[model samples]
Target: MNTTHRTIVSRRARPAKEPLSQEVIVKQAFLLLREEGISGLTMRKVAKTLDTGASSLYVYVKDLQELSSYVLDYALASVKLPDSDSEEWKNNLFAALISYQQVLYKDPGVAELALTTMPLGPHSLALSEYLLKQLAASGMQAASAAWGLDLLLMHVTSSAFEHVSWAKNEKRSFTLMKEAYLSADASQFPFIHSHKNELFSGDASNNERFLWGMEVILQGILKQDQ
Candidate 1:
């Protein structure tokens, strides 16, 4: 039987039998996540993987959400944020964002967790503070900086996760999208048809697109200052 379908009892009634630590639980959870992705990382599944009852896991982890928080915290703690004190705030901001996205790519679904819950993990808070500091020093108002942080997180997480979804689903989405774009009615989408090449042109790297998007955001922020 698949491990997921195997019958497992909760430890609430039975005494805990596993001699594992929270560290071990977190480590094994990471493996499960890497092997099965988010949907496969569950408290019950983790207990089965660890050869313990589902209730035993509660001693180390409250729920799947808390388990995810632990893993995300452990992952973020290892990343080195770009220097947050640079006078060139725009450069610093974009570099930090790129680094953040790359880190998210290291383990899929962690970015979505961060984006939705905005967890107060120590490392997450540190990055948030760094971004706020850089934005504030760039002469952005408190309210604007607050919203700006949310905007950047939403953009990076959504964009990177979309890439992950495409990879996971084995979707040749862009090629199909290009075909549709190029085949659209010429009279209705004259400009889109004309610039189809430029619009669809990319060498499978999001770096240039990301940089351009950041530049546009920075320009808008600068306008707010003026």
Candidate 2:
């Protein structure tokens, strides 16, 4: 009468993990950048987010800087380039560059990376090629198009990078800057005194400033074409 009883155990199958590669690592790094921003994208942090060891990340990237750089390149892949006609090419190019700036602004660390790093990754190269093509079609000569890439990127990245830095600094004190302007011996600085409201008008209106700059550059480009 020693009838036996059996116990059944149930288990849920786990999902297969994505295979690890440089691309995979960079993808995770991008998520970290979006979540915690540039400073939060340390190697250890990214590793933890990816559920892997910090050492494992080295298999893909050389170091934390390289990892951040990789994240920039990875993010760049999302930028879609259109192949519209050269007609209205100046405006088309302006719109494209604006898209590029918006992409960097959305991802804080990227503008600095784009500015400092050479065009290496696939997306960066594609962007460069697209800009060059558009510039040529927009009536830029060989030299103008060649330097135009540098000019456009330099201006956009510098502006975007400064804004990113300003954004991240919780202790950012514009008080002194504003004070200086206000105190600028109004006798000599008639314009600053008169336009104080316009000058100190805060961050919410940056789009106008950005547009003004792009418009000036576009005007210069148009004159070159002429």
Best by TM-score: 1
81 Cα displacement, candidate 2 (Å): 2.8
For each candidate in the order shown, give its overall lDDT on alpha carbons: 0.76, 0.76
Mark the 10 consecutive residues where model 2 has the least summed lDDT.
Answer: 7-16
Q: Predict model 1's lDDT versus the native.
A: 0.76
Q: Write the per-residue lDDT of candidate 2 for residues 86-112, one digit (tens) a residue.
A: 786767677777778888888776766
| Residue 210's lDDT in candidate 2 | 75
Task: Name the TM-score of candidate 2.
Answer: 0.77
Q: Estimate the overall C-alpha local distance difference test score of candidate 2.
A: 0.76
In model 1, the clashing pairs are: 11-55
